[model samples]
Target: MNLRFGLPQPLLSFTLLLVWLMLAGASAGNVVLGLVLAWLLPLFTQGFWPDNPAIHKPWKLVWYVLKVIVDIVVASITVARLVLSFRREPNSAFICYPLTLEHPLGITMLASTISLTPGTVSADISDDYKMLLIHALDVTDDEALMADIHKRYEKPLLELFS
Candidate 1:
């Protein structure tokens, strides 16, 4: 168990195991097959894992994912309501949100999270990656939207990846 792997091997193993379980569904036979696949796949691909930011907190990771799920549901409803309102709302506009999280992985996760939620899409990342341009279905309050993103996704992501 050399530290050269950067992260503990068990953590990587557990992640692969969970991914297998999700991909195979929840049946007992699938679970057993997933476990076997999880164990064997990593052994053949050891070099693909990168040694980067160490996630020191597991609870924060769980919280971040849970928050994203809730946000996605809320955004879906908002988008549905706007769509059903019959031309009451204007087409969305692009908004520039200043970002403080500099990590590449963190920025990527943020972008993907924004895109996954309905009513919003990640349009561009600035050349310096210091700003994110997001298009919202209804651009009522730019400041409020930025604040919401910061409080909801960015803050937790900063904790998790930065």
Candidate 2:
């Protein structure tokens, strides 16, 4: 008996199942359908994935998520204040942030994190995947911005996905 049976992307499969259950409710029929789709979708899409991403520390991932939520709230308030500020116009500029993490999934997460935060949008990534271009609504000091992103976001992602 060959007992090798498991989802290729177990985390993704479980997450999709969870989402489906949430959206479709926890009835038996819904549960059955969600589980089936969750299992089958990963199998069907396995070919599209280049490399499987592994999260080394689940605890750190939880912490990273909490930090991202807090940053989003803080950024929203900051952007709101800037919009209402009569003192001065925002110092908006495009910044090229150098990348230390090489994984595609890691870079993608970083880009998404930047875009999700208010007042900052991830504009582009370099061809060599060495830099990320970001458009900030109001950034007076570039070094400080880069430092915050590297420490708060990039570092944790590197830890998680590497």
Candidate 3:
């Protein structure tokens, strides 16, 4: 059979089913309904499906997610401490860091990961995709911050997406 959709139908169906079950709170009836919807919805929208690039290493993706969670927690605590300490810390400043990963998906993931963490926000990405401008809540060492972000988040993302 010449499937017009270039992606694997089974994987797409399974992903949709899982999403539906989670959204519906995993009730037995919802599970069955989700399965039906998952199958039918993909079949109906097959023409609209886009090609997904193959993931080279699934384990790296899992590790990246875990690291993000850990970073979020640690950053939250650190930010909270700074807020409560009543010290006259300097107002945050924007810092631009050079980036090497040119993949669009990798850049998007990097931006999201940085914004999701406490005390740091992704302000903008340069048009050329060569630099990422970030705002830090506490403007301490800019070099250290950039290095930490690259090492903790960007490097792992490179592994997963690039």
Candidate 4:
């Protein structure tokens, strides 16, 4: 690891400082506090990050984010419609989704994507990290849900992190 100005993770520190500034505004106190926190956080957490996550296809990340955003919007409408309707009940069910992506970061991204979509939450991951437990608000077709997730989210993540 290259240490610049006594900082182990310069990029992370810079990102943290930028986020702090954006959230707290550009006051003198905020600037000083943000700088201190940014510098200190990387130092404190350096040991926890065993390895830095690598992005094999940075372009895919942009596309993947866009897809997720679209899914979020669509799912939000579906969930809202289900909630407002009184005639039909949501067929809520727990799904044990089999995992294909092996990388921890990839699996984490997949889990996050599932949770980010409305009407679905990633409940837990198996100890061996081979399967994921997901809960959906409504499910007409279980197999279809799993397939869609695999094709849309997991496949891209697998490719991205490979």
Candidate 5:
């Protein structure tokens, strides 16, 4: 049976359900309420969603998430040390990274990931969306920073979205 009522993206529904349950706890009443919200939320908001892309590699996504977590920890330490040192004015920079991933969601994810790391912020995307502008708090080497973003974040997102 087609239960979507036009809500074709079931994963989002499941995630909403799980998030609700986690917040409310997994009591029987919570589970039932969570299920109800999960089912109805998607139906209610289907029009707001664009075409949902299928995730081609779930395993790769898990690995990518782990790598991001590791990077975040490392970057946090690096930023903290830089801040405490107060030994030098940070070599801050705004980097224009040329984009390869054309998907809107992918681009958004890439921007979000960059901003998630310590000492960096995604300032803007180009009007054409062909490039992303990022501000690094302490960039001793622009090329290295660009390479890191290209390899660590952009590549995996391209693989996932494409």
Candidate 6:
């Protein structure tokens, strides 16, 4: 038995524990079961993952998560307002956003973040991974939307996964 088998992937284990606890309701039994599963699942399945991306700056991830949460909240309110106002149709548009970050995980995080926020959904990504398609409920300025995504989401992910 390898010594590292006890904790092959710390982040995955933590996420699995939290998810298990959330779904199973955090009783003592559930906690113990969650811990067991968290430890064992990663150890057993570690071979399937070809590459595990390293976090260059783990602290930045916290800030990035907080920022996304705030954006979700603000977007929820904006979307609610738009929905309530029946007279004006939302300036809906599909945007082709060119991606800059080279890492697949970083691109995935960026797409997930965009989808999590209200009024915007990541529709698709190009085959070459050069562009992402986004559908927005309201998009008055294409350049501004692209720039905002690049600045708020992509930049941090690039730094985090670098």
Stretches of model 3 off by over 4 angstroms after superposition: 1-50
What digit string (tens of lDDT, one per residue) describes model 4 on residues 13-129?
Answer: 999999999999999999999999999999988888757678889999999999999999999999999999999888999999999998898999999999999999999999999
Model 3, 66: alpha-carbon shift in Å? 1.4
Better of 3 and 4 by lDDT: 4
Listed per model in order, the count of residue pairs whose N, CA or C atoms clash below 3 Å is 0, 0, 0, 0, 0, 0
Question: Which of the predicted structures, 1 or 3, would earn the higher TM-score when compared with the native?
Answer: 3
Q: Record all residue pairs in model 5 with backbone atoms less than 3 Å apart, i.e. clashing.
A: none
Q: Tell me, what's the RMSD of every candidate?
A: 4.8, 3.4, 4.0, 2.5, 3.1, 3.6
Kindly provide the TM-score of model 4 when superposed on the true structure, using C-alpha atoms.
0.86
Which pairs clash in model 2?
none
Off by over 4 Å in 6: 1-3, 10-40
lDDT of 6: 0.93
Between candidates 1 and 2, the one scoring higher on lDDT is 2
Question: How high is the lDDT of residue 60 in model 4?
Answer: 94
What is residue 126's positional error in candidate 3, in angstroms? 1.7
lDDT of 2 by residue, 35-135 (tens): 99988998888888777667888799899999999999999999999999899999999999999999898999899999999999999999999999999
lDDT (Cα, tens digit) per residue for candidate 1, span 1-162? 344344335566678878877876889998888767666676666677555666667699888888889988988888888888896966678999999888888899899999999988999999999999999988888999999999999988888875
Clashes of 3: 0
Candidate 4 ranges beyond 4 A from true positions: 2-6, 19-37
Q: Tell me the TM-score of model 3.
A: 0.73
Off by over 4 Å in 5: 1-7, 14-37
Query: What's the residue-level lDDT of 74 in candidate 5?
Result: 97
- The total number of steric clashes, by the backbone 3 Å criterion, in model 5 comes to 0
The candidate that achieves the highest TM-score relative to the unseen native structure: 4
